[model samples]
Target: MRRIRRMLVPAFAMALVFPAVLPAQAAPIRATVKSIEFEGMAAPASVKEMADQYSTASLKVTYSDGSVKTFPLSYNRLFKTTDSIGGTVAGVAIDHKGAPIIDNSVPANPTPYVSDSPDSNSLFQVPGMAPSALGGNALSLVTHYEYITFDNANQSAYGLIPASMSLTTLDQNKQTGELKPTELNKIDFSGVNGLWIPCNGSLSPWNTHLGSEEYDPDARAYEADPKATFISPFVQAYYQDKTKTGNPYDYGYIVEVKANADKSTQVAKHYSMGRFSHELTKIAPDGKTALFGDDGGNTMLFLYVADKAQDLSSGTLYAAKWVQKSAANGGSADLQWIKLGHGTDAELKVLVDKGLRFSDIFETSDKAAEGFTAIKTYPSGKIEYLKVKPGMEKAAAFLESRRYGAMLGATSEFNKMEGVTINEKDRKAYVAMSYVEKAMEKDAKGADPADDIQVDKISSGVTYELDLAGGAKDRDGSAIDSAYVPTFMSGLVVGEDLAKADALGNKAAVDKVANPDNLSYSESLRTLFIGEDSGMHVNNYLWAYNVDTHKLSRIMSVPAGAEATGLQFVEDLNGFSYIMSNFQHPGDELLLPDPLKIEVLAEINKSFENRKAGGVGYISGLPSMKQIVEAAPVIGDDNPTDKSLVDLRAKAAAAGAKLEWHGKNKDIVVTLGKHSLTTRVDSSTATIDGKKVNLPAATQFSKGKTYFSAAIWDQFIKL
Candidate 1:
C-alpha cells in the first residue's frame, strides 16, 4: 500500500476533517509533549518546521521558564517522538546538512556530551557503531532472544508459520497490536543456519519471505564448473544445516517456508531460482513471474523466474541487454535468459562442483560493456574463488601469486545492486543499485589501496525500470523468455530496437538516480518507501516516494545502529502500518537439523477439504492483541535497584537536559554518582547542594547512580 506523505497534501485552502473515527483505541492513551529543555543549544529551528510537516497537531512545548515553542510532528516512524524515553536517534533531518544525525541523549543518566561529527567516512571505524549514533552500543549488537507472540487459536512459535496478520498499531514501545507476546509459543527459528539478518524482506506471492543471509560463507567449491569460478551468493534453504563452510554461497536463490501447517516439518527448498546476492523479490502483479536483483559488488544482473511456482524448474533467467550507442536510447534492456538448458543430474552436479562461481566468460563480456552485451559464458563476470578453497592450506599462497585481473575476475554490467520492485500497473520491473564514485580510492588520497574504503565517495542509490514486452524478447542474440534455460541463465531476446532502447535506459539512469537505499511497496499505504544504508558515519534514513507527488524526501532514519536493511510493509492487528527491519542480530544462532519442520501435506490435507468448501483455510491478517497482552504481563523492572526508577526518571530529565562542552579538549565528563539528594515521598522535599526544595510525587527525580564520564556535562532537573 502506498503511504501518503504529508507533503503531498498540497497546501489546500481548506482542511478536510473527517469524523473522529480513529481505529478503535483499545487503550486510554495520549501522548502529551510536556516541555522542552535545551542543553548546548535550544530546540532546533527546524523542529517547528518538522512538526508542521508530519505531526498530527502542532506540538506545544513549554519550557521551564514561561516561554513556549511550537512545531510539527513527523509522520514517519523514524521521526516520530513517542513512548520511548531513551533510545539512539539516527536519521537525516532537513537541518543536519542532509547527513544522518545521531542523538544518544538518555534522561536516566543525563550527561551532556559532544563527540566528533561523523559523516560517511568515520562511521565504520567502530564495528557496531557505524550504523547507529552510539559508537559501540548498537542494537544489532544485542543477542537475539527467543520471543513469542499470540495467535488466534493459541500461542504459536515464530517461523513455525508465515505470520499473516495485519498490524493495527505500533506503540512507542515498538510492539505491534496484533502480534502479541506470550510464553507458550516459543520456537527456535535458528534451526541450523543461524539468526537470519533482519533485512526487512518481502513476502513473495507464494507466501515466502525473501530473507537474505548477511554472512560471508566459508569459501567452498560447490560448483565445480571449470568454466565458471564466481557465483552470485543467494541460495535457497532454511539456514538449518551447518557445514565446514556456512549455508551455501551468498548468491541469490529462493527458499520457501510453507505456512498453514498442521504439524511441523513444513520447510522445503525449490532449487530453481538461480544463485546470486539477493536484496529482495517481487512477482509480477499477476503473481506468476518473479524478478530479483544480484547485489554483488561486481557487475550484477537482474533475474527473472517465469511461472516460478509451477514450472520455474525449466524456465528462463535473463539479464538486461542495453543498446551500446543510440542517442534516442532509453537505458532499457532486452531480457537475455542464460542458455544453460535443463542439464542432466550429472551436468547439474558438474555445475555445482565447478564451484558456484558464475562463468568467467559471461563476466568478461558484460562487465565493461554497456547495453545488450552478448552472454557467451554462464555469468557475465569473473570468478574469484578459483584459487581459494575452504580446507586448502595453500589457499592464501595461491591467491598471492595470482594476477590481479584474474583474481579480480570479470565485471558485470552494474555496480552494487540492492533493492528490487515491480510496477505491476505499468508492467515494469525496477532494479536498484548503490552508486559508488569510481574516482575515490580506499584512503582519502594515497594512504593505501587496501585501507578501509574512506568515508565519503559520493553515493547515490539508483533504480532501473524495465519493460518486459514481446514475451521477454530482445534481438542481438540476447535470450528471450524460454523454459529450457539454466536456473541462472539470462533470457535471450531478438529485437535490435529492444536492445538499443534497453542500453539507452541504463545510461540515462545513472544521471537520474537518487541516494535512496532500500525500496518496498506498501499495499496498504499504497506508497513506496526508500531507505538509506549507513554510508560512512552518516546514519541510514527512510524516505518515502509519493506516487502522487513523484518526489522523494527524507522521512526518518532507522533507530541508530540498525542500518535499514530489508523493508516489508505489514498490517497490524489494529490495522496500522508497520515496516519491519530484517536486523542482523549479533548472537543469532545456527543449529543443525532443525527440529520444528512441518509436513506440508499433512497440514494442507486437513485444511484443503474444508478450504475447498469455503473455509478460506488461512491465518487472518489481524491478531488478537487482548490475548497477547494478557499473556504478556506488564513487565516490571528487571533490576533489583529501586534505583531503577530513580535512574529512569533521571534519564528522562537528562534526555531533555542540555550542557555545553567545557573541557579544553572539547571532551568533558559528568558524574551522576557524585551527586546525592534526599527526597520525601508525599510532600517530597529534596536537598540539593544543602538547599531544601519541595518536590511533588509528579516531580521527576534527578538521582540514579553516582557515575558520570568525561563526555557528559550537567543534567536538567525536570521539577
Candidate 2:
C-alpha cells in the first residue's frame, strides 16, 4: 500500500498539467477604468461583486487579462467603507436608483464624526466616543460619552445628531473612583442627519428607521400661517435651502429614512403626523396609522395617518385619559380615547345654508389641504361616528383649539418620556422615561463650607404597551374598539425597581411594580431587557423580562463603573447584532485597562458602620444604593482653584443654596444626620475676593455630627 501511494503522489501532481485539471475561474477583469478620487473625502461607493470584496481600486492586479470587469458598489457592513476594486469610480451620490447624478446636495453638512477641531477639549480625548458627534451642548455629554448627571443642575433637552459621527469619551467616575475603560470609534453615516436625540424610535418593516424631531420653538415654528418660519437642525441643510424653511406652522411631523439607501438622501417628513414636539412614533406594519407619544412635558398621546391614508386635512386625533385610581399612580391607570374636530363646521353648515365660510363642510377642505401638496397631500373631511363623548367634549375641544390658552393644560401631563417602540407583529406600543435626578447642596454653618447639594435622584424607565382599540364597549357587553385610546399594552416592561419601605423605614416588599426603566426588546431573542439600578458595583444593568413568567432575569450585567444608558441594536453588514451603550465615566467599579478586560468590583468598605447593605436608598426620588467606591476629584494642587466648582456653586446659589470646601485631601465626607456622601479631593489654595485661604475648610472644623464638608469633589452634609 505504501509503495502504491508513493507512485500515486507523483502521478496526481503531474495530472495538474492537463488543461481539464483546472476548474473554471472567475472571468478576468478587462476594462482599464481610470481611478476617480475625491481630494478631501473618500468615495461613497463600495465594491459589490464578491470578487471585489477585498480588492481595492489601488491594486493593479491583472484580472483575466481585461474582460471589461466593472466594479460596482453594494451594501456590505455597518460602520465600514465599501471595498475598493482595481479602479475607483467617482462616488456618485444618486437618487433612489443607481444612476449617477450631478448635484448631490441633500443636507450637505460635513458629518460631525470628524472633529470640528482637534483641540484637547475635543471628544476624541475621552477614549470613548459619544453617541452623536454633531449633538450640541447637553446632547454632547451623552453623545460624547456614557455619562449620568446624578445631580440635576445640568439637565436640559437637546437635539439629535446624525448616527455616522458618534463622539465617544472616557470619563473618571466620581462615585466609584474607578477609571472606566473608554474605547471610542467614529461612524460616518452617509446621507443621514437630524437624529432624534436618544428618543424612542421605531424600525420599519422595510428595514428603514423612523423618528420624530423633538424640535422646540427655537428650532421650529408652528404658527397658523402656511408660510411659517423654520430652522433646520442641520447647519448645511439650513443654509442651502433657506427658502424651504418650514413655516413655524408647518414644523412638527414624523421623518422617515430609507436606511438601505445612501445616508445623504433627504429624509421626507410625513407632515400628516401634525406639527408638535412629536416625541415617539410607531408605524403599523401595514404602514398606515402611526401611534405617537407627545413629550413636550405634558401632552396627549397622538395618533395620525402616514400620508398614504386618505385623510390629510382631518383625521381622528385622540387624547388618552387614563382611567385609574388617582390617574397618577402610574400603572393603575387605563386610557380613554377621544377624537378631535374643527368645531366651526357649524359655520360651514351656515355656508351651506346661508353661504358664509364656504358652500359646504367639504367645500374649502380642498383649499385647506392644497397648502402642502408636495407629497400628494389632501385633507380628509369630517368623518361621522368618530365618537366624541358629550362629557369629553370640552377636553377634545381644547385639544383642537388653535388658541394657546385653551391647550395649556390640555397635554402637559405626559412629560419627559424617553423611549418609544412598537412590536408591529403584536400591535403594541412601548414608551419609557430618561429619569432625572437633582442634588441640592448648601453650606452647613458659615460661608466657610461650600454649596454641595444633590436632588431628584429618581430613575425612570418604564415600558407601557398600548391597546389600539379605544376602551368604549359595544351593545353586547363586549369591549368597544373606540374606547381604545392607546393604553399600556399588557406584555412588555423595563427599568429599576424601588425597594418598598415600611413605616419604620425597614424593607417592606420589593418595589418591583413601580420601577422598571430603560426597556429594550429583541424579537429574535423573544426577550425584553430592562436597565435596572443595581446597587454598589454596577449602578444599572440590562435585565431580561420574561413575558410568559413575568420574571426579571439578569441576562448580562453592565461592567463596573459603567451604567447602560442607551441600548440600540445596529445590524452590521454580516447580519450580526451589536449593542451600543453609554458607559458613564468614573464608573462605580474599577475599570480594567484597555484591551477589553472588565471586572465588577465589590465595595471594600462595606462595614456595619457605613450603613449596612440592606436595601437601596433614594437619590432624589428614585431608588438607588450607595456606590461602593467614591470618584476621585479631577482637580489637583497644580489645577487648584479650578472653575470646576465655581459654576456648580453659582448654579446652586441661583437655585437657592451656597457651597464651601469641607476637607483638603482625605476622602471628604458630607453627612446629613444619618445619610452621608463621601469622595476624594486634592489639596488647593483659594483666593476669594483677594482673601487667601489655605487648604479646605475641613482643616478648621472640629468633629461634629451636624456639620458636612465639600472637600475635593464629593459633597457631604450633616444628617
Candidate 2 clash figure, as a count: 109
lDDT of 2: 0.30
Model 2 lDDT per residue over 1-719, tens place: 00000000000000001121122242211111111110111211211110111111111111111212222211111111111112211111221122212222234632111111010001112113233222321111112211112111222112211112122222323332112223222322222222222233445545444545543332111223322322332322322333542222223345554321111223544443444455446555555556665443333455553334322223434344434322121333455443433223222222223321111111222222432111110011111112233343432232222112112222223434545555444545566533322111112343311111212233443456665554453223444223223554332343332365333121212223223334455443334545433232222344444443354443233323333334443322121223333322223333233322222122211211111111100001100111100111111222234333423333334434344446565434333323223333332432221222333433222233222223322322100
Identify the runs in model 2 with alpha carbons over 4 angstroms from their true place: 1-198, 218-252, 259-266, 307-316, 326-329, 341-411, 423-427, 434-461, 470-518, 523-525, 531-538, 556-719
Name the lDDT of candidate 1.
0.29
Query: Candidate 1, 424: how far from true, in Å?
Result: 1.6
**Full-model lDDT for every candidate:** 0.29, 0.30
In model 2, which range of ten residues has the least summed lDDT? 1-10
Error of 2 at 252 (Å): 4.3
Q: List, in order, the clash count of every candidate structure.
A: 144, 109
Q: After superposition, how far is residue 431 of candidate 1 from its true place, in Å?
A: 2.3
Stretches of candidate 1 exceeding 4 Å from the true structure: 1-179, 183-200, 214-252, 261-265, 306-314, 324-411, 439-458, 474-514, 523-526, 560-562, 571-576, 581-719
